[model samples]
Target: MIAQSAARHYANFKGLPKGRSELEESSLMARSTTLAFSGLLLAAAPASALARDYLVHDQKEYRAAAGAVKAGDVIRLAEGEWKDFPILLEGQGTAKQPITLTVQTKGKVILTGASSLRMAGSHLLVSGLVFRDGSAPGAEVISFRRDPRSYARHSRLTEVVIDRYNKADRRTEDRWVSIYGSDNRVDHSWFAGKGNLGVTLAVIRPKGQPEANRHRIDHNYFGPRPPLGSNGGETIRLGTSDESLSDSANLVEANVFDRCDGEVEIVSVKSGANVVRSNLILESQGAIVLRHGNGNRVERNVFLGKAKPHTGGVRVINEGQIVRDNYMEGLAGTDFTSALAVMNGVPGSAINRYHAVSGAEIANNSMFEVARVTLGAGADAERTAAPTGSRLTNNLITGQDGKPFRVEADMVGVTFTDNVTDGEVPGAIPSGLRKTGIATKRAANGLLYPTDPALAAQGAPRDLRPVMVAEVGPAWYPKATGIAAFGSGRAVPVKAGGLEAAVAAARPGDTLKLAAGHYTAEAPLRISVPLTVSGPRDADIAFSAPTLFQLEEGAALRLEGLSITGDKAPRQSGNAVIRTSALSTVANYALEIDGTAFSRLDSAPAFDLIATTPGTFADRIAITKAAVNGLSGAVLAAAAETEGKGRYAAEHIAIADSRFEKIGSLAQILRAGTDESTFGPELILRGNTVVQSGPVMLGLSGVQSILIEGNTFRSSGRIAVANSVGTPETRIIDNHFIQTPEPTVTKLYPQGSPRVLVSGNSIGGDAS
Candidate 1:
């Protein structure tokens, strides 16, 4: 009976004709006026008068009231901070009136700090709740099932917000919403700021359950998921690789993805027989990858990449995939992230591996100024099978490189007809895309519409204007930007007595001017926001705690014109006086120290001035007009790697007009191996004085570019180039090593003709 009611409700939602049972009152009214509980004396009052409504004040009251809640009952939780509340709304309701678990007033209740909800049983509804500023105790913030034997069907979750519910460690895998069961719908909601390692929302079909879930996810806002820097960071995922052959038949439509640069797959479709249409992707650096699915339809979607780096469209990987009528503009990715990629498949593959593309259709699409449209992409040794029996017809494309499309492998049974490009259509993946000189007309919204009449008639009507996430979510929820800016745009003054509190209250982009006095850092200060601490030259700090300052993700600190003295316990690595957190966000950080002095008391194994946590990196670090005297290890060590893959931390490090006397090596900026697809390992050192800093000053390895000019080294060791994995570009000119009997530069590798440019440097009191 409940399944019949679910079918009837879905039919009613689809505007289908009412059968002999249901009342045909109107479309606006979702429910019929039918009650079947022996009428209970047959009152002519509305269903609300007969239905029970409970106002719960606390968890004990809620637990007491939950058992007695019946069909058509409404449980309204009062507005407050519902922290650590484990909510379970388990009941049975008819299709017309679902058991509602909602807030007393909309947008007023906050569920935070280990709160989770599970809606088990049939015809349940949950709405108007906000999960904010806390992490869930479990893997999911809200699950649609309680246990293995019980789950929610005909359920609806609407008008909700999950904003920045992150664990302190972003590597901790947690999801905002996980859906199971069938005929469920999630709409008009907002999910944002998932910096962790899981998909934001997932339609999960666990093993031993092969039923088609048939979930509808529509009209929601997916906002600002920054790169997790690893896999498993998709915004919406349909199913798992283990359930790839099962037909979940999910529908994802009318959604907006804004700046979701989690991974190369933004919306990962791993289930079969799904419909993905009418969605808008804005500046996300990933594709809607049909990763392990088959017989899926991708149509009428809009990809406005805006020429951002690595933004893409659709990627086809399986059989019977139909991609058509999509309009894309300004995409800037290539190869695997092409605007439209028809990929090669693994031979004799498992269900988890890539299936070969067969009987695919690519038709009636219009692309404007995209980077590439690759066919048979990733055709290596294992994925040697080419896409066969596919039709590429009636598509219009204009590209930046003039050649929009390329064929990687042999086109065995593929056919191309009536396809037009502004550049030459390529014959091979690395080769030609022939220019047809086709004259095309642009639409009013600045996208190319199809010129062929049959292709034009085949296109569906869609709203082509760009959609902002702010338009669909609840009106009270603010649209979150990817990089959070907490600055109040005001300055604050700090004294020695109030330094810690001032640092704690300071926002990003703020400046704290310290008074000229002595201070003691007895407790470690963790600075996670970009702040500047400036003081006069007479100001000095004594460090007694484990590292006076610890840098976190996206944080940058500037120490200006201050003196520092530390007598901390001796440590070898990963324990610098200033260090990034090992569990920081996988994003860039920066540090700048200018006109500062460092003095170690009692020579207690002088700490490195600044070091990064292993596997974390800095975008930039600048040290100018600074004087330091240290005892041992590398002062700036950003050279940690993942199991010696030779990954370095900082992108650009520049030290100019600084004096290092009686200290250790100046900087060890090393990237071990050569992978040219990544960005910089660069350095700039000029006009510095190094005196009596023996053995090493600059330990360079796999550095792409460096400019070492106009410095004086007094009897210090040479700047050694250790690794020749990449063509290291080096320039050492016009420096003076005062009476130092060592060669100025040493190339460690035996690779011939290292690109070191050395000239006009005085070594051992003679100009060379």
Candidate 2:
């Protein structure tokens, strides 16, 4: 009878029904029959050998109960709020009788306010709990391994939810989940709203451990996350940069990433021999970047961009990578999402740099409505070496217009065969090289798949069904069909022109893209609307005159991915890179500069805000992922004088994930003052590397709150943060002050009011 039941279950698993209710009912029935058979086998054992259950209501009871837990024991947490409770779960259980920690009622037990779990055991399971609306501060919310000789082995975490578990400052670095053990499984979990600075889920392979970290992360839901605007914000990272060469045989499959746009790489594979397959990425602004791995496999995944800008496909960098059997739809990215971007590797590159792509096999992938599919990206000025021994075959690509394949002039030894495309291929490939299999076209009703029979079998498997909510997320339902679904289509490109002409022709929300060239404007360009001007990593823009870009009233500019070089031979005295005029309205404005570089300026600030009107304010100024060098003046300065009776302030300043070298001579890097009536900037200067030539002075007269965390400051002079009113909440924690004197915080109030929190900072040494 048990064999008959098992056969029935296997048959149902292979041919499951399509509807959500039918699948759920079938799954439940299967589990029930299996459990009943297991119970029948256990009936013959002794009563003392039966699995035991312990109920715990609070942290105190949980601690007492955990101590007595043994093999085949189940600890059930009561339906209540576990606030600020740090749980250390340690146990030993056999593979057949694993220790389980679960809630009495799933989704009823809430863990909040620094409540965390650190597991150290083998064959243990933690399931059915919610962690939300709170923080663990400096620690991960869910950690598999404990400190000082405790490590988990063969453990599993299922049906767990970690949402919005942030630090106090929201800028401190702490991961939501850290897996640091061998053969651990984290499946059927949901992670969302991880707003801090770290990977949402990180798999670590410790040094000197011979065994691989063979972890499995499957059937989980990674929900929406706002852009961190910097690095170190991947949804799932296999290994760290230091461990990039290690072999971590991990598997990440059957998951859904729903708008998980945390940073450039949605899922970063840093270690070798990992498999990322059968996942659904929906409307995310990054690719599955194989940053530092070899012999990794990325297959059978689906990327549904819905024509979202910056939504990307697979990006290959290192060698021995295989990307095949995948489906992509509605991608609107250029270099990052070019269907398949084979990056150009620098010669003698380190692990961090783009490594040479050799022995890579990209096959049997299907793309619809994508941007340019490129080979040898990032090769022009960087002079990255072309790929070798890479083969592209059996791919199907269809787009609206333009070239389907773009190959750099330097690309060599890349073989293409049996590829089918509706658009024109690049000129690098010979006309008769490809054996086309299908003449694909888009559906007339705007669906992802084509209605014509000629294109029906071009992409993913024809038997597969479209992705559904039940097939994704924490609830793992068996897929009825094998095919991946197509997403909606939209495309926005940066048109080609001169710098000024492109800017003139662009409307609001358009990105004016510049290529790799030297663009010198005749005069300072006046920007009056919200616009984005972006370029490649190697593009350079120089100004003949000072103040290359001017911001008028109600003007906002997002400068991205460019190298800005100010002419050291000044066109005029006191020339700056960017100058903002005094505001005429009381509305708050902003300037966001990302992935840019400013260098070789004689004595000018990067941003010179001339505040003539007192009532006007720039609300948010965020400069992230930039490199600034050779600045002999302040990087940012509020003009010394103010006009009118009201006050002028620049509030909410964040400069994170940037590098500053040889800065500051005549003035401080950042200079802002607040009068007694108005509040100053709420500044967060985190995760920056500063190599300064002189003392770094922070002139915060009336600042509201300042958080300087995780910054490395290498200087020989004393650093001073002088506050006039002494009312700001200042916290200077976890900063590495190397070869520098101890930082002094000066407050004008003699009563010692509004004291600064200064701890966990290492002075005169490296802090790592």
Candidate 3:
């Protein structure tokens, strides 16, 4: 066991000499005295494992000293930046007493990456060095050999800085630092602007036997270099490919990221556990991740963006992981922030046929200015089972550029709920305010509203709710931001009848009210004006009133109220509630569907909603609710196209709520035509209860992507969600599934096969 040392802290010191002569003189004096003493010590039995500490100044001396050192010895470097030269330590040491390579000066000491530090040892400890000016093609500044029999066990690398000050080589293979074997600790380090990755822990063989390597990387800073765009590098990574079958268990925690080009990766592993927590990421492309090897955990990180929008976020492929309690923000372009976005399907080749994301938990995260929270779609996903056994809950969210969140409908055991959305406004509401409610389900403490739509009209500051819940009051409102809710009378007020009234009559800034009742019909409520909607659960009363509820056409609508329902109108037919589109053609409704509750009351009939419009009416809708239920005919419905190339297509929708049940033939369904005309449609479902339906709970066709999150499901159906051709991507995750059969959990078809990811859900089903 390594003895724990006090945590090291750093402060910038401006006045440090940058001359080599002084360092050379100091090195000569220290070496001459050390040599004189070495003769006296060698005369005796040389107690304490024949150890020696050499003071190296130049690259030549450093290399010679390292070769001469014994297994249980050390080589301490003098304080100074040594540009362009790397020292490799290929030695062996026992567990009891290991070799140590250290830097005595806490000041600026650099080991330029002229070469690589390849280690093939049983024990090695490296600490307190700044490595810059990387060289060699695809060569890491410091790397270790991949050997199952030998490893850098009980090794510690502390307080090292790797950057691009010396000069960077544009090689795919060269990274800032690389480690092959395990049982190593890399802590309190800084990495910036290197290569594909700042730090990597992978098997060099590409494919090999299962070797157990473990590492701990903590308290590091990873970001881009100065002047921006100089070196587009990624963060840390841990993985092994089929070429190298070796697996490693690693822990990455408490790191800082300012901006990076690539994503942090945790890829292929045989069986291992990795945990990431309490870090900060700002203005970076994102992190690449693959937890396929085994167990992993990611939690408690803060992410922020400046002027530019972040490209991507954390992506998790075939693996079981736990992700929770992280904050994300994209100040511009709403194209950032994804918590646990899964890329590939399951781990094993044959197991992927089930369409499941086995064993993952995503919960309690705050997001803002993100286009889509999750994304997955590809050819490998055909007939594949979406991710399964995941739970999502109690997260606050804001913004909808791409789509808030998406998921595969066929996913099993994914739940979402207990989230809030409060957007920023410039002065008044811009065009398109009324939101549309997507086909989604949820359960518990969810507040979905365009709370302050007008606040962010002309590039206004973002509206972030300070307090998540109202401890004292049963109802909650946007906290005062010093700006009046009405926007100094410049804003108009939202009207009673859905989005049309808000757009036609509202001004640049205004507020509106919504009555509480099954408010579904006004299909596509559009609003071209600015407004706000505020009312008590009892005060506002509105419902999808059969024919009257269908939203008006070509109107930018912004509607907010309580207890909103997306169930299709009560058809004149039999006991089956319309699971498809009951009310269609609220033409051209660019509405912001906010503050609506979606649920199925115990006393209400089961089949109350459906999607028959075939991509008609509901367009550009955003839904936010407190709860939801799936009993009433497919929680939310997507229309199927019958005719036309691209005449009418449903695109850009969202749903958020709690208390959503999973019942009947379809819970959340989407459908479309075969051609490209039916493309470019997306749905983001977040923070809601999702449960099992009777048969085919969710059905879809001809669409782009679907995101599901934070809900609970009962689990008893055929294909918890089913989709058809034209379905580009589907992300089913962060939900709960109980008592579900393996067959009924999830299913997907060809033709627009989506990249299915089932993660972060609590599952209690019979997969067998």
lDDT of 2 at 155: 81
Error of 3 at 331 (Å): 7.2
Best by lDDT: 1
Better of 1 and 3 by lDDT: 1
* Candidate 1 lDDT over residue span 193-220, tens digit each: 7766688999999987877888878768
> lDDT tens string, model 2, 1-768?
443353234223322132213323533553464454244223312223676778899989999989988866778899989898898889996555567788778778989887889999887778778887688845688899778479888887877888767764433578889998787877667887765567899997665653568787776788876555335668999986667776788878767888876666899998888888767888887889898978888877788898876688998988799998788988876654566788778788877666888899988788887876878865643435789998887777876464667776355568877677777766688742343434444443223554557546555554333344464444522222211111111113442337877665555456676777777776877766667778887778877766777776446677889988876335445566776653333223567889999888755543222222232346567889988887765556543323321133464678899888776631232223322222335678899887864565344444546788998878745656665432356789998888867777876543213548999998776523
Compare candidates 2 and 3 on lDDT and give the better one. 2
TM agreement with the true structure for every prediction: 0.74, 0.59, 0.46
Please state the error at residue 213 of candidate 1 in Å: 1.1
What's the TM for model 2? 0.59
Q: Best-fitting candidate, measured by TM-score?
A: 1
